[model samples]
Target: MSERRRQFDRDGFLVLPGFASPEACAGLVAAAERIVAETDVDALETIFDAKGQGHGRDRWFLDSGPEVRAFLEDTPEGPKRVNKLGHALHDRVPEFRAFSDDPRLDALVRELGVAAPRLLQSMLIFKYPRVGGEVPAHQDASYLYTEPVSVIGLWFALEEATLENGCLEALPGSHRLGLRSRYRRDGDRAFTERLDPRPWPRAGWRPLPVPAGTLVVLHGLLAHRSAANRSPDPRRAYALHVIDAETEYAADNWLQRPADMPLRGFSTPA
Candidate 1:
């Protein structure tokens, strides 16, 4: 086995520094800023409550699986603070598609044991200073579940992620703990269904602070969370979730694309 695969198997995650060029990171940051500037908050009704009971599920949030949409932060400071732009930024946005479809990603996924990697979801997260909400401990498999649990996440830091700006915190070898819950869609409503009663272990947890061009590879079941941003600098990141196409995607998964719009691989044209 390759050293990268061995490390991922043992740790459930990998930190690859300089995976993206500084210019690439800066361009993505500028693109995200432009998207936020152009977003019309007056028409938006979904306040993204990351820590709420519903977990930010709504018509706008649930139906954004196949398209690009903006979600606001759950803060009294009003609706201008966009928590993230998500679900299909990689397939719809030119800048994001270019960044996500790099040849390096294809090779990386292959080395990680994914025979055919399909892009499941993508998000441009904007943890605005002071108002960025906390993301609780959770696993990616809970959301984008597959029968055998074959999903990987590539999280790119568009800006330097620091402890002060709410960088990712995770349990080192948590993927072996099995799935804790599954986010299911029941018609128009969506909710999380518990699969395990045991809570995430607090021991061996660590904060992962990385530079702007760093890429954090996460196993699908890795328990991870981020605190609310308290610093003046914003924590901006781009995340892409990919799954092995050979696995069976749960039919009732909350985020589902239209039949016509199938998931694409890294080398596929947008």
Candidate 2:
């Protein structure tokens, strides 16, 4: 069996404890906090309120907020404020890039059997105390499209993720069964079409129990969702999507990438 098969079988999810360190998490937290703090130099636009926490009369229900957008504040012109801290924190850092394309990261993907990996997208997710974000039951591929159904998602914990803080909960091994067709006005085509909703057999359903600093690599088809931050503390996770390198992007815009992108030979970016 492959390393991924073993890990997924044993723990339902693979937790590379300490994949990220406390110190590293601290810096990121501070940087993100600065962005939340409204300031003159850093005026943000929309905060993309995932929970609709501070929505006003004008706020609308978006399927999903911008992958990267400005952080909002309490003022009337709040939503217009760019996510100053978020943008600055990630944009100015070399580590984020390094981590995203890290050879070790690629190796983990290889270990998972994703022959060649393609860097798709990356984003930082933060769930604050009692912020309980609502995530409908569905596998990621139900929302994202990638070839071969072998896209590996690397979620790096930036804080001590606990049940209270609402860590990412996933049903592992579900990828083997293939994608589930789901429907959402704002859902990804990968799962937009309605198929069998039942995650049958109960043999492949594995819910993850991950800790802070750990890297959990999961197949995109694996069913997963972020739990609500029910505790007084906050939970932060940075996720990056890497697909089998033979993967292709055949679209003009991001919302839609062509299902068929040309494939390349076996090679590592490292």
Candidate 3:
């Protein structure tokens, strides 16, 4: 395994500097703009594309919508899947190739006691101003029901991720805890009311500070989330989800099986 993997295994995640570069980030942003522009907004009148738009059923997102449509978009009864942003980003870029692969990332998983590794889902999470919101403190594995929590996520920040603009905060070594106590479903929560996420209180909360082109790779069981975008400008991050080869596609979760498209660090799975 690569030294990068060693760092991740020890720290739950690592922030690699300049993974893509400003030029590459610009390319991803431009590609996203094209998708929004070409999208048929009129066809999609009352649309909603917040978080996990497509789980069991396909989500409806209009070309120009500030937020979810309240009714249709809220309450994720079905499995939660990444929204159109993921689909578009995956369709455009070609730099996300080694984010999940490479001898390092692959070895890290194998060393985790899992057999082979296969990417299950990947998506781009763009944060809009004002309306774009915060993700509560919770573990990524909570939403993922697959036992063993072998699935992990790679977060690629396309823009400067600062505290003012809402950076991702992770609980150091949270992955070692192995799916920290889950929470019961409350009507208030959106998607993750079913699982435990710090059902009790904790200390030593840390926020990740990484600039554009930086990648924050974490274990699937890691506890982390981000705040709302408060910066005057927009912040965008491409969230790519990868699963171990031993994992089977359970009928319950949302799956992103994009066609042979060109995306950075993700065109081909290792």
Candidate 4:
């Protein structure tokens, strides 16, 4: 087994500093900035608060499985700020597509035992300067669930992620804690159903402040969270969630796509 796989198995997450080039990170940041600049905030009313009630069940949030869509948020600074551009940024944006299709990702997943990995979801998360909200500690499997829990997250830092700018903090070996809840859709409504009542640890989370172009690989069931950005600079990141193609994706999982929009693997051309 590769060293990275061994480390991930032990820690539930891996930080690969400088995994991406400086130029690549800059390109992604520029693309996301352009999208935000062009967006009409006044028309976008639904907010994307991860800690909100029902986890945002509106049509604008629920129906963004196949296309690129933007979600706004009301921060300490103000309302209507772009919270994230998600679901299919990699599939729709040329600049994002190029970065998402990097061959190194293919080899990395294979080494980690993710055979026939499929790209399940993508998002550019924005931690707006002095306004980004706190992301509650949670497991990724609760959202993008699979039969055997095959989901994994590749979070790339497009800018410096520091303590002041809300870098990621993770509980080592927390994947073994098992899934705590499921974010499900029933009819048109969405809700989180508790599967385990065990409380997350109050301490022991290790902060992962990293430089630009760093990649943080997270296990599906890992417990991770980030604080509100209080610095002058914004913290930008591109997150890709992948799952083993062989696993059975739960039908009730909140994010769903039409049959025509089949999931693509790293080996498949964009």
Candidate 5:
């Protein structure tokens, strides 16, 4: 195995500083903002309120809007925000689609021994200031289960991710523990159960703070989670999940949508 792959294998995750250029990251953020501004309330209701229902191509999925609104103070403020906007931006939005098809990411996945890695899911997680929800420690395989559990996450920071703003925290080498039972979910739109019965050493958890444009590659079985944003600034990031094309993606996976398609390979970036 290559040195980089070895490092990831040992740590269950790898942080690549400045993986995306500043200009690229800015463009992505702008695209997300535009999606929110242009999306109508009807669309938002359909995406956020309707559980397990799939919106047509290139639509924003606003699963967390109601919760965010409920948590908002009564003062007149900006409109409510959702926890994420995705699962299909890669296939629909030009900028996101371009980023998804970026050859450098595919090359890295290939280097990690994932021959023909296919894109499984894409999400732009919004950790809104103060009201951002905490994600419980869990494994990606719990949601993206495959025969050998080939799913891997490429999480890119679109803005500075700091501990005060809920940066990702992971337990190094935790992937060795193998798959654990998944957190129960009411529907595709609800918060995942935060508590897992399995005991984890709290001391081993490490917070990873990365600047905009950095990429964090994670193993599917790695135990990781992020806290709620307590700071006044928002924490925004893009996460793309991919799996080996050779594996069978079970139909029962929680993220399944009718728009789902086969993962495609991209050429290396210049």
Candidate 6:
């Protein structure tokens, strides 16, 4: 195995600086900005609960505008921003579609020894100033569970991710501890469960600050979380997750949406 792959297996995550060129990253940012500006929040599918289920767009907005607005927050100087634009972008946005199909990502996943890697989901995360919510420590497998737990996340930094702006922090070697149960949600947004009972020591968790265009690859079972952004600048990112196509996707996984196209160069199983 290559050194990078070995490092990933040991650390539960890998950070590659400048994984995407400046121009490429700029293009993605432009696309994201345009989509955010054009999208009618009321017309988009709403994920109102922690279980990741909600009434589809039509019903959520027209039928329950006041309740939904109560759950959302507006910025003092700018328009309200959703925490993330979910998997639907792979089909609706051209830039995201291209990024998801990038051959470089395929090569990296191949090095991880996953066979026939398939694109599981894509998200454009808007960690906007002040209002960007805190994500609790958790494993991706809890939501995107597979029988053998083969999910891998590729998080690309579109802007400077800093300690002041709520960059991702992770517990090294935590993936080796195996998957944990999902956190119980208290409301439309907050997590109620505590991480004190986990096997790893929280004191050893480290902050991972990456410059724009960097890529952070995460193991499915890795325990990771990010703080709420309190800085004046926004910390934006694009996260694409892939799974080994040969593995069986669990029926009970919270994210039951249909899988997007497999990454290029990986064979689709018959």
lDDT for each of the candidates? 0.89, 0.53, 0.56, 0.89, 0.73, 0.70
Candidate 5: RMSD over Cα atoms?
5.9
lDDT of 3 at 197: 35
- The deviation in Å at residue 191 for candidate 3 is 6.4
TM-score of each: 0.97, 0.68, 0.69, 0.97, 0.80, 0.79
State the TM-score for model 3.
0.69
- Tell me the lDDT of model 5 at 27: 92
Residue 17 in model 2: lDDT = 84
Q: Please give, for residues 160-225, the per-residue lDDT of candidate 6 as tens digits.
A: 899989899999999988666743323233232334455556588999999998999999999888
Q: Please provide, for model 3 over 114-169, each residue's C-alpha lDDT reduced to its tens digit, 9 standing for 90 to 100.
A: 57566544555656554346776666565444555666776878898888777999
- Candidate 3 worst ten-residue window by lDDT: 62-71
> In model 1, how large is the Cα lDDT of residue 114?
84
* Comparing 2 and 6 on TM-score, the stronger one: 6
lDDT of 5 by residue, 8-31 (tens): 889999999989999999899899
Q: Once superposed on the true structure, which residue ranges of model 3 sit more than 4 Å away at CA?
A: 1-3, 41-84, 87-115, 180-202, 256-270
TM-score-wise, the better of 1 and 5 is 1
| Pick by lDDT: 4 or 5, better one | 4
Off by over 4 Å in 1: 53-57, 77-79
lDDT of 4 by residue, 156-185 (tens): 999999999999999999998899999998
Q: What is the Å distance of residue 231 in model 3 from its true position?
A: 1.2
**CA lDDT, candidate 3, residue 90:** 33
Question: Tens digit of lDDT per residue, candidate 2, span 1-270?
Answer: 786668765444577787767876676566555544545434333444433323222122121122233344223532233222232122234555444545677677777777766555555676656653544455655434555455666778887777667776766566666667632332322114557766445454444556677888766777666666678976767776666756553232123323352222223232
